[model samples]
Target chain A: MKLFKDAGHLFRLAGVFLLGTLSFLAIRAFVVPHSFGQYGHYRGAAIAEIAAHPVHFAGHQTCETCHSDIAQTKSAGKHAQVNCEACHGPLAKHADDPSIDPGKPDVAVLCVRCHSASAARPKDFPQVDADQHSGGIPCTTCHQPHNPVIAAGGAK
Target chain B: MPGVEGFMYPNEISLYWSVLIVLYPFITGLVAGAFILASLERVFRVEAVRPTYRLALLTALAFLLVAPLPLQLHLGHPERSLEMYMTPHRTSAMAMFGFVYLWYLMAVLTVEIWLDYRADIVALSNSTTGWRRWLYRILTLGSQNVSERALHIDERVGWLITLIGIPSAFLLHGYVGFIFGSIKANPWWSSPLMPVVFIFSAMVSGIAAVMLLYMVLMRLRRQPIDMSCVDTIAQYLLYIFIIDFSLEMLDLIHRIYEADESFRSLDFMVHTRLWLSQVVLQICIGTLTPILLLFLVQVTKLSVPVRKRIYVVSGSLALIGIFAMRWNVVIGGQLFSKSFLGYTTYKMALATREGLLVSIALTILPLVILWVLVKLLPPWPEKRHAPLPAALAAD
Candidate 1:
């Protein structure tokens, strides 16, 4: 009788533990406040953070020192709004070595992050796609980096 | 003149009271329309509409509860939107909304529903135990007696409340339409027929909802549906849909006849940008199809199965069509540029908690409320054994 009672108590304890674990899992999956998606949800501050802390991502400035012409055009264009890490993903090893070249990331996916109509961006913004944008001109040719528009004064 | 650049579509209009403001009345119109249907049976003793009366009231309440959510979401500072009430600003049309909401919820609907169900609540309280017993008792409000006198008093009070509620319902939804109609800035929303159009369409949607719900509920319970009850509801739905569709056509006619300076741009928008939504979906699929189906069912003297199928299909169409109408009026109107030169597109994002997910949750919340309401009040009166129909037995 003592052994039977002990077994019953152990079963109840197991039931309680199982209930707790299930509840925790549900809350984590459905209700918890975790940031979501990479489209419009990416804050400008994250871009600024990447800009301010160049040492963290193999310093775009170091590349600028060696490759001035490409860097100048890139800095001037609208692509300036985006950080290299956002488009290329993490690049700690590639940043450390000058000899190893990391090829351009998937251009279609990167552009669609902002350009797609259904992408999680501004509501009033118009739909965009590579086909619609390609009028015998590449995105870089028309857009320039960080600056889509050219100012009156150049970097003379 | 050749060298000058002119804006095809202007961006000069202020979006102060925009699309969100327009939806407020559309939703309220549904609430009022549903409540008025409930009043037809509850107050006027319309035996044919008995099945729909309770369902109508609950539908009205459900829509009413969520009416302000869109407006709240639209406001730049939703938290500060409450300041309209605290300051008691007379010029602010939105200030009166809170008072209107409270009066309907507390002074009218709550009282009428309670009085209507007092006897049933008392009975349910006695039959049940545990939390349900306590719930029923509280709902009964300590009224244990189910005597004829008590019921008579309840019926009288319920009637009075319903009478008072009808005008409040009109004001709530009508005011919403009026706000849009009065906006002189947006020519698209500035028609005088806007309020009339809103109220009638609301009626169309409301009557259709009750009919669909009644059919579904009866089927679920394995009970035989009363064809007379359903026919009556369908008949009312047809009447309202005709008026609603006619008013919309009349507005279009008026716009064309007037041929204002904005006519070209507006016409282009209807033909090009909104052709699918306005011409195809709203007119052809939503309104015309349901109206035709309802007409065939009523005029043709069809078989039971055929009529039932038509009624369900028509009701479902009318509900969806009315929602599409609201969407077109709110979102579609905003897509065209004020300059009449260019049109901008709106892209709704997926996976956002504030977007479609919230709307779905709000829409389905009422089902939960209705289920609990049935569990508590049992909308229909209890069935008692009788040798003959009540009307014949009495005679």
Candidate 2:
């Protein structure tokens, strides 16, 4: 009590600080999402909200359903493991309605997304200098999108 | 893939932390540095530096006010930043920023500055009229008593705050360093020396900034520049710069000797992409040249005019060096792919949100704030008691 009397102004300052801090903490407690940090660092409900979003990219199995011939050709090629939608944009809408063909891809752009020469890429991967190799021609002009081996002058 | 030079991870294609992130540390560094310079006079009893004591505090307050702006601007949901305080992740280093920033702002800087200016504020409140009087009155926080005993208490409390402020300043900037250093993914940023380098560099930049401001302000006000004060500050700047340079060199040497898996990739980057910014500008033009110029001043008996020129040149260069250091740490850390396979480029947009224009604006914002703070507080002692009240005039 004597300490407070001697330094009442300091106490007032401290009191102001405490009041501000408590107010901040109270407001924080009120506004923070209830389900946050339930499992990890973020709101758990966010995961559910994200999952609830409509699927955009229809999977390879769905692509295989309608275009079985292309799927068989792709299966026999070097890009057998590559998914159909990896080169083509999300096709869930096109998959549901066959009347709307997803249309031909920008073959040069799609090919170089993976094949662009980079030291970081795996050595055995089919890399290319798009400008030098193709000379302004589309990738689909020579190499078939589904069967790359046959069009690259390899065994069919 | 278009802007990318080499193989980058799919996610690394777009840089998450932009130029605004670089400004965050640079601004915070200035705040921490200015406060530490203020502490030299208050706590360390450096009488020669008394001229800069109040100005340093106000400069710190101005920059500190703007310190979090860049971070806020950089956030995807700037409004949601309040969640940091509300539901802070206990395990994350970034989460501690809110508490640290708050404590420094409220408990340390604001309180210390208020106590230091309480008597002046009370006097101003009584002397001024209309809005000015009310402004000072509100500023006094209803504690109008400026008795000798009250002032003595204020002095003691202010001294204690300055003592605490030194370490808090260290924590404020060192924590910024740790945010980058603790990221185990990037070898460029993940070094133990990062925090130490940051603290020393903050000291260098802050001292240099205050020194330059003091000279420029004195020239503007038509007051004679204090050579002793500038000399003392330059001495401190040189010493801290030496330590900062040494620590950075140590980090470099360790990396070179170890030649870790990330070494080849980083080495390539330093040789190619970072050659201009890191090597020529930061090291040669900014760091070494300033250190040499300041060193010459220390050894020689040059005229005041020559010494002043040296101080200005060196101070400007030190600031540029430290800014470059922040640039290297923040931007350079992101330039290289985590896979160590390729590198990417940062094409700073002109007028966009995190563009060069916004960065320039943010950089100048603190100076404008300091101008306002200096106008309101009038940090110079000669200007402090211009309108003293009669009752307090006797003391």
Candidate 3:
């Protein structure tokens, strides 16, 4: 007790620090999700939450149902492996109602997303210097949408 | 693409980090630098800088409080930032920021400050009445004992905390640089020297800031400026500035000599897009001018008035140069495409979330907080010389 004589201030400060540390631990426990660190550092619930979102991309088979002509043409062209929704975006709603039009995809801007020349891309991958290849003209101007290599004139 | 030049990757058109991101390192650098300046007086026993010791600590505290604001503002979901504390990724350099920040703020800066100011707070609490008395009393944390023995304990503990603080300050800013330097993909930022460069530059800016603040505050208080303090601070600033500039040049010269694949791209960027900010503002007006001015004062037998003028000019420029350095690091790193064939432009918006307005406000916010802190704790030890407000004078 004699050692603590003038160090009462330190004891009081220590009490405050102890109170703060405990409070922080309590708050951290309360705020942290129950499933956090279940699998790793992130919340386990996040994976399931993300997976629960409604499916948006109607598969190639669904598009092949009605547009067999385009599918047949694409099957023979350079884009045989490419899916309808890959370029067109999510068309599940359009598939639900054919009358609901999925407007023309901007080939000018959209084509460069994949075709832009970069050293990182695979050597075999069909890439181009977008500016040099097309200038200001759209990709659809020279290449067909359904059969790109076939060159079916410009866009309608 | 409108503001962009050359052949930027489609994804590289828009810059991810904005001006707000630039402020993060700048603010934290100030905090680190200021604490280091304060530590010189405490641990290193540099009595010449004793005049600005408390001011430097308070400046560090003020800036440290605002360091995370820019990062929080930059986040799409500011609320999720708390998750960094809850579940920090071990492998991530950035996610570890929360822990580093907390440790520096809570353990080092605040503790050191409280220990150093414990006696003063106790004295103020007993001497004053009304709201101020209540405020100081609370700040004392019921530690009313300020006996000679207790004072000795405070001084000893304060010195020890500062000794710990020196390395902690280095870690704080060096970690900021690591966030950029460790990113292997970005050659502009990826360098082993990044952390060292950041630490030295931080010291330069921090010392300059405290010096300016001390001068201006003293002038405002109608007290005679501490010429010896400013002169010593200026000398240190010059030495540190030379180191910072040399580190930057070394990085540049190494890149030139090596002429790596990314070198051509980064070089072109420096000559073109970064011409104004990097070369003009940061190196010329901001860095070289201040260093030269400080050097001149050091070599020449200048009068007090002339030296004061030189200090003000150089200090302001030093702060500007440091801000420009941060800008170049953050913005310049993002400008060049990873493909090494393209460049993009940063279009800073106004009145938006991460806009120029917000950045300006965030920059000013720390100064405002410093003002309030100055009023509350009175970092000025010579309080009798300070010009008080009517109500405060009465109290």
Top candidate on lDDT is 3
Residue B254 lDDT (model 3): 93
CAPRI grade of model 1: incorrect
Q: What TM-score, over all chains together, does every model reach? A: 0.67, 0.83, 0.86
Instruction: Tell me the spans in candidate 2 whose CA falls farther than 4 Å from its real position.
Output: A1-6, A44-156, B1-16, B337-343, B385-395
Worst 10 residues of 3 chain B by lDDT: B384-393
Per-residue lDDT over A3-96 for candidate 2, one digit per residue giving the tens place of the 0 to 100 score: 4454666667777878988998788778777888888877889999999999999999999997899898888888899898888889999998
| Ranking of predictions according to TM-score | 3, 2, 1
Between 2 and 3, whose DockQ is larger? Answer: 3
- The residue-by-residue lDDT of candidate 3 on B1-395, one tens digit each, is 47877777768889999999999999999999999999988888788998899899999999999999998889877788887776778888898988999999998988888887777788788889999999999989887776666666666777788888899999999999999999999999999999999999999999999999999999998999989899999999999999999999999899999999998899899999999999999999999999999999988999999999999999999999999999999999999988888888999999999999999999899899999988877876665222322432353
Q: Provide the clash count, candidate 2.
A: 0
Each prediction's whole-model lDDT (CA):
0.69, 0.87, 0.88
Query: What TM-score does structure 2 among the candidates reach?
Result: 0.83
Model 2 chain A, poorest ten-residue lDDT window? A147-156
Model 1, CA-based lDDT: 0.69
Please write out the lDDT profile of model 1 over residues B1-395, one tens digit for every residue: 12112332333222233444445555676678788789877666667987778777877777777778767866657766654444345665667767677778777877677666666676778888999999987665554655554455455556788989888777776776776677788788898898778778888877887788788988998888889888888888898899999999999999999999888888987887678877888888889999999998877889888889999999888877887787777766676666666555544534443456556665676667777666566665343111222333353
Q: Residue B186's C-alpha lDDT in candidate 2?
A: 85
